[model samples]
Target: MSTRTLPPPPPPAEVRCWPDREALLADRAKAMAELHRLSIGVPRLLLLWLLACGLAVGWGLVGAALKTFEESRPDALSALFGVIFACTAAGFLIPTGIVMGLGVRRDKTVRERLTQWSSLDRDPTNDARFRSPGVSLCWFVPSFLLCTLGLWLSFATPATAERGQETYADVTMLMGLGLILWLTGLLGIAKAVSHFRWAVRLVTAVPVSAGDGGHR
Candidate 1:
């Protein structure tokens, strides 16, 4: 992952001063695009995590099938289960691995773009730093409710044979946690996207710099 930070903004007074919108809009658009590029990695990381969970589930199903076969005799159904589990695992793992790997590769490119855009002499928008507290609350509200319901169901439901005698409570707990984490990650990515949109609007609204200007 790229560890570089964006350069700091100019003085407060300069930030208050607006430049020529007509002249700076094009350059601002380019800079906004670059900023947008920097925000994709976190979402890709989240997706990778999701796929890993799927792989784990598939592996568990396969293990159950194997255990069943060893305890008794291999049946057509058992073989089918094993095959299905293998395919499911591969289905989740392969494409996700590829996409996440691509995201890693693109991280450097995004950082480089940010560096190039930083040379412009404009104050940075508070887009990334300026999220409303209510925004986070809104995201967490659904997550909390879902987690609560999931816990109730996990405890209420019985364990299935496919789960190898594991309690529904146990499995549900694991799944619920995974869901929470995934949702949290999605929230992060969404915030990053929102920041980009806010940056675009901020750029449009801010006064254009006469001598030099940069964008968020």
Candidate 2:
């Protein structure tokens, strides 16, 4: 009286049929360009600038608190202010750090998943819009200038203090601001380079035919 168990039906296969090779290439190029645009869009850039500014301000606050502690005899008001500054700095820094760490992790995971999902089929550089010089230069100039300015500020002697009168707290604030700027600029430069390289690669790459397993 035992009943036979039937196996579950196999999942249905999903297929995308393109009208022609040109249609498929156009679709792929559009997708790749869109991804590039999203990566360096204005909203993302603004967020990065805000994050850098927050870190810089947090570090400055920490420096101020440390300066108060270095005073031989800080008054009650000064000490209270120092504590407040420290607490505020911690509030800003902790959340900023967490957001940055989480963003990096999420971006990595998304990129890995995307790599597994599909691949390029044709040279996207064939499209004039995709290989526009304006796009790369717009990113490069600002990034290069920021990097240069940051380096100069980091090494230049502080004008506020005489050579022998500089305090550790002052130095800490200057260095922290400079470091954040340097890192931000470097990130921008990397993005610009990546964009340039992608354009170049696309231009030189051979277009794959749909029959040759061009996309997966």
Candidate 3:
């Protein structure tokens, strides 16, 4: 029987420990804590902002619907509506357009912010504990439905009030459209924020237990 000697198994590869990566990951929890601190005041600020927009839409809808400026002056309210809607649409589209326009700027910001934290790095592990991506879809769905309904209601009727004509439908539609956009905008903002927050958590993560026995 020939004893076969396998070349002494290649010297076990040297193990390398990446303490910096680990340290960064551990520090990510601090990012969440900082975010929490920021959110404490942010929620109320957001709430107030929301309340103000609601009031604007509410008052505008009431004013437009109750007042027959559109009907009384065929060219008047229609023109006013066009102007206001155009301005509002422009306002939203402008900033978003600018951000999206310079594609590099936005992407860079997202990538950089995700990797870094103003106060601490993002924790990759902690990100897993939060919500799923599909979570965002919930917020936009309502905006789509409401906006659709609002649009339908707005155009179905005549602007002028006559023996049987009413412009309330149009007014309601405008308001609904405004609200839909407003709410959807909020959802979009939230989604963007979440992405970066998650990104921060992701960048600072290191797989301590990857392949065989590793530093956990």
Residues forming the 10-long window of minimal summed lDDT in candidate 2: 1-10
lDDT string, candidate 1, 99-214, tens digits? 55565555545544553343333445533343334444443454455445545444444433256666443454455444434444454445445545554544554443444443
Model 1 residue runs over 4 Å out of place are 1-25, 34-73, 123-216
CA lDDT, every prediction? 0.48, 0.62, 0.44
Candidate 2 — what's its lDDT? 0.62
Report the C-alpha lDDT of model 2 over 7-26, residue by residue, as the tens digit.
11111223445656666666
| Model 1 worst lDDT run, 10 consecutive residues | 2-11
- Candidate 1's TM-score reads 0.42
The better candidate by lDDT, 2 or 3, is: 2
Model 3: lDDT to the true structure: 0.44
Each prediction's RMSD over C-alphas, in Å, is: 9.1, 9.2, 15.2
- Scored by TM-score, the top model is 2
94, model 1: CA deviation in Å? 1.5
Per-residue accuracy of model 3 over 3-53 as CA lDDT, tens digit each: 121111111224534356465444444544444333323342354345435
List the candidate 3 regions with Cα displacement exceeding 4 Å: 1-19, 32-49, 52-58, 61-115, 118-124, 131-138, 150-164, 168-216
